[model samples]
Target: MHNATSRELNVDVAIIGAGPAGLTAGYLLTKAGKSVAIIEKDETYVGGISRTVEHEGYRFDIGGHRFFSKSAAVVDLWNEILPDDFIQRPRMSRIYYEGKFYSYPLRAFEALSNLGILRSTACMASYLWYKAFPIKTVKSFEDWTTNQFGQKLYSIFFKTYTEKVWGMPCDEMSADWAAQRIKGLSLWSAVTDGLKRSLGLNKKPNDGMETKTLLETFRYPRQGPGMMWEAARDKIVATGKGQVIMGYGLEQLAADGEGGWRMSATNKDGDKVVVKAGHAISSAPMRELGARLHPLPETSWNGSNLKYRDFLTVALMVEGEDLFPDNWIYIHDSKVQVGRVQNFRSWSPEMIPDEKMACVGLEYFCFEGDGLWDMADADLVDLATTEMKTLGLLDPAKVKGGAVVRQEKAYPVYDEDYAANVAAMRGELEHKYQTLHLVGRNGMHRYNNQDHAMMTAMLTVENILAGERVYDIWCVNEDAEYHEAGDEGAEKALPAREQVSEDQAAALNSMRDVPERIVEADADETAADRRVA
Candidate 1:
């Protein structure tokens, strides 16, 4: 069961998972003249879900990642890692429903015209009825969305795509998610804005007051997002003080008895790797890390209780011109199981090796052992092709080839108990292992973007270097903006827990925004009975 031979390395810090968080920490630690070792489970890629996969000279992103952040430090670090490779690309995304493409912000005339007169009248009537007799208590996504945009519009525009992404019915999802994601916008506002645009009266420059979701352009690496991580990995190795050990996954983490950690990992060949470090930074899923720890903490079960959502991308190579100008389109049609489609050429021309052939990624969200995830690669490709044709976006005859990439734990699940579980686990781990730091999306069980993950790692590195927790890294919000700002590498301390206002403290304690599944009540009762009750 075990290999006799073993390799050992001593480092100031041992990092797990060579994702954005771990790699960022390793790079920063090495740059600070510290010995570091980073271990990644994947043998071929470093960017985790953000990695670009290449097949037959065609490169495609697992899920389209737009490089945009509100944090200056994150943007600076992105530029610092791969300075010359960054390219500015226009951002375009739309929702595809029935047989029409509607602007994401919803242009009034276009949306009305797309829906025939009868359907438009029904939608308006639904909106008026809901407004007149709104649900007294908005508890679930269905309730909140229907209250805002009416039931007809919600079913047409939101239900299918949202359900596909989360793998749950909208009525079973918490309203908090809807409130957070679709904040500052309502049907009335959208109509007003749309009408203004239709009449050429809405000419205003974005002064940072505009909604953050409606981004116009973003920077991306010419090659792919993986290029950024690859560059960081090379730079870390060039430091001569860091080592990135791929194909090795953490098996055990125990105390060294000298106030440090002894991390053991094994590769597919069963070769063991031991890293003795003064500090350990883990970007691994909290559940996996809990299971690997020796003399596990009392609240370790909370970590195990944390859940995750998996994702897979089916990239189809088609023999034709580019399908759409948008980088990606959300498939709101319930007729197909596909959630979204990403166009490689729209992301960057360099991503496609052959200009004549177009590559598009059909993304599906599913559980690890579900039928979709267990589907054969060829079957997945075929399913993608059929769905594309059904959506009128593809021609089956023009399909040349296809490839499928599956990613486990792509999005951390936000269930009813996730917050409490994460809090208990974090409290225990931080108290027991002062030198152990959890960073990144899975590490914290937060659904954060790449920049937010990097910010956590950056703050963790600062804490390690200072030998104390000077920054409350948890204060990094979903917007990738730190609640409190400090100069780069500066040691400005975060305010004490008691010093912040209640609202500020709540913000600090809150996890990044992700939809949570609503727990059902009274399994024995009928739907009508439950509603009446």
Candidate 2:
């Protein structure tokens, strides 16, 4: 029924999906005096999964986003964009299993007590046995995790929650995901850290080596991550970038024959907006982007084959002043459909307007159009309430109200052939469309953090401005070039890694050497170039 006359607009760049990556690219390009248009499918919200949802006076995150990054550029950009809204939040999370909460990072005594002496002894024995005779070829997540944390600990701590998140058996999932997410962490390190914690040695390890997951604190927007995105959106528009057109669902994208692109998008009010641009950056899911391209590229098949896991958050507003202190809890209980529970109050006290009430988000990972996804909002809320009550987390009767937000393509699944499929798609896209670039999680079919998504966008803009691939966007992963340069030097310097523990050094020895980053930048010349451009 979208019958309204199509309005056309021309710009230097057209970006699909006004997410973290798209907005970052738009903001930087606009700052550099490039005209840009960003189209977002969501009628509301600027951040994709990172956006904060508000109901009544309560605010919650989709999946909790910790503003922690290894990249100095990303951290600097965040500070520049939203300087005042950030709050230092103490990291607290637990694994809820068998009607007990086990501290994550495994509080030694707590974990030992929970598992009991016999089980603890057995776990240790299993770990030593696995270490002595480790799996030679680690093909699956189960294999890799068992090698690191032992089969016993992997089954107890990692298997259930991971299965719930991916909706797949651990053995069937790709080992790359485990390596990426939980790299540099092992049972030995956790036990040492736990021992230190129990001894009240709460300072960072003297060796200065720690896993990403073991970070003790993180930054979060006082209101939510949406505040940062909203600020970015405002700055982009203020600098004369094209207005961020929300509710614009791209229907088709085609080459306009003049080394440019023509895009047709549908709005909520049954209106179509046609945009023509010299360059295009997309944060849209690879699958959706494939479907929208006329005479689809060879990459479309790979994109179609790439899988995604959807997510939904059921925010249950309860009548309680004080709830659990953890920012979130992983539900390792196989009986419950909810994979995790977020304590919004702990994230930021400002989230809950009333001191008498607390809001918790019950996160369920599901496939789009599945039974859980298809369930009515009320039914989902009831289910969440019942599950929470069953877990003895909270009383079902105390749940006063609820809100549901379903996110599609929430996680790009890492299956057996995902790497090959993504490689094929990337190669084809890079070769076929010189100006068409993909960034962000779903955009690249890479499960990355918001900062990584922003890094991709930042590099993409750099390429667009240079009219060449100046920076390789694919290198922004776990072992990517992470600069520890201070605020002023972040743009220029590439620093060395901090002194590492022996264990960390051993871990690094197994991987290939990190290539030196070579970016020659004459600051004075660049300043002059900015003015000349």
Candidate 3:
């Protein structure tokens, strides 16, 4: 970390936000002998959405980060940074609906028994009906899901919990959201996966073969994800290659005439600090960053209009050695506003400071300044207690104490206008600011996982070092192939040698110098390969 007392400073790179993206860039750049400065608004936290919150003696992640990635580079990076601290954890989660807990991945017999013979029959019939008469035009999440899982199962499983998370009717939400999240998942696929998983066929750690939904195990930092970022921060500072300045909120930014950026920030005590850097990588929320620009571009309007979904977690300390066995459970019942519940002990036993007591986080999704967000912490804790008892997950009397954490702009809203707005903003930024690059979820206004965000940062660093846009960060999470592309995709149109066919390899070798990373990482996954394999 850098001393905030410095009134004026300069660096080779100025990064906004100390999240996964910013820290990854900082780590890689600093390791390559570049001077860097990371400016983070929050004085205490470093991982942004991936941070861990310590309340009293109990520690819990804001959003539990399962260190699983198809990208070999991302996986290798994780192993490089926090190898010793990583713990392999079994993945177990369930869906709580109507006072019953159904195993996630939808255990066949459990779901059947819980839904009863008649309702189960109805669900199968509905699935067949949808297969026979699928929706011609699937515009909304409801429509898309109904077509895939049938109306009965969609209503029984997806509808209520999804609505609680997005705070909108399923019909009002975009189908793109569903498509991006559950692209290959269908009723038959889920059933087959569930049965296979039950038989221990997909129990291995993610090795690129298992779909994300079927993964039975994952890695996690022993202390929490923050352990990784905190280590990265210390390593960068120790190497004297970078300085991470905390509590410095960016106030204004302008392009320096000398092919760089001049950034002004306000420190915790209201002191202003100025920095001049040759390049800047921003992971700040697009909306917030747009408001801080000097001589703002035309895309500022679109940036300002970008919407975000906020989240709050109420950590309840209960008097018990055992809670529910699952790492987390989706609260599918519409009766309660709590969207999900997480048992910290299930994530990692070390997460709880006390062996005799269990810590659980009741997660609620809501808009900033809305009823749930504005509710008092005490009331929110009470609500969690009541809901836990109502769901039969815990007893209200056993609740010892609680704490609350509210995260604003936790998720970028994927609405009707988001794509157009983001495109405009991205176009203007790329054209106007040669030295400025946007990376990460809030930075790009894209809903991506931690590894995906890290992949963007890794590519951004490569681009900076190569003195050009050598990689397209946008393609990181587009598909399995992109994730598998790794360093090979940093320079070529095709994947690593063994993953591509001879013709594809020849095509890549013959291609002219492309400005950005290959957009089609999956360009070689031909139908013939699937059939042959």
Q: State each model's CA lDDT, in order.
A: 0.83, 0.78, 0.78
Between 1 and 3, whose lDDT is larger? 1
The TM-score measured for candidate 1 stands at 0.89
Clashing pairs in 1: none
Candidate 2 residue pairs in backbone clash: none
- Model 2 Cα lDDT, one tens digit per residue, 195-260: 686698865652223433355567899988889999999999998765799998989989887778
Number of clashes in every candidate structure?
A: 0, 0, 0
Query: Model 1 over residues 1-533: C-alpha lDDT tens digits?
Result: 65467989999999999999999999999999999999999999998878888888889887888886555567778989999998988888898988899876545445666899899888878888888877666778998888887889889888998899888899999888888766444566555665676688887522212344455677889989999999999999999999999999999999877779999999988889999999999999999998899878786355667888899999999998999999999999999999999999999999999889999999999999999999999999999999999999989999999999999999988888888888888898888888999999889888888877887898788888888987677776564223222232232233344443342233333445678876665567444542312
lDDT of 3 by residue, 1-533 (tens): 55545487889999999999999999999999999989999989899999988887788899778776655577778888877998888878888888888866555445755887799889988888888878765656787788877889889787998878877788666665666555434456545555667789976322212354356676789888989999888888988989998989999888877789888889877777788899999999988888887768774355767888899999999997767888898988878889989999988888998898999999999999999999999999999999988888888888999999999998887665677888888888888876799999899987777877887888788779979875666655523223222232233322432443442223222211101111222566543442212
Candidate 3's C-alpha runs over 4 A off are: 1-6, 107-109, 121-138, 147-151, 175-213, 299-301, 478-533
Cα-based TM-score, every candidate: 0.89, 0.82, 0.82
Q: What would the C-alpha RMSD of candidate 3 be, to one decimal place?
A: 9.0
- Residue 361 deviation, candidate 3, in Å? 0.6
Distance (Å) between predicted and true CA of 196, model 1? Answer: 9.7
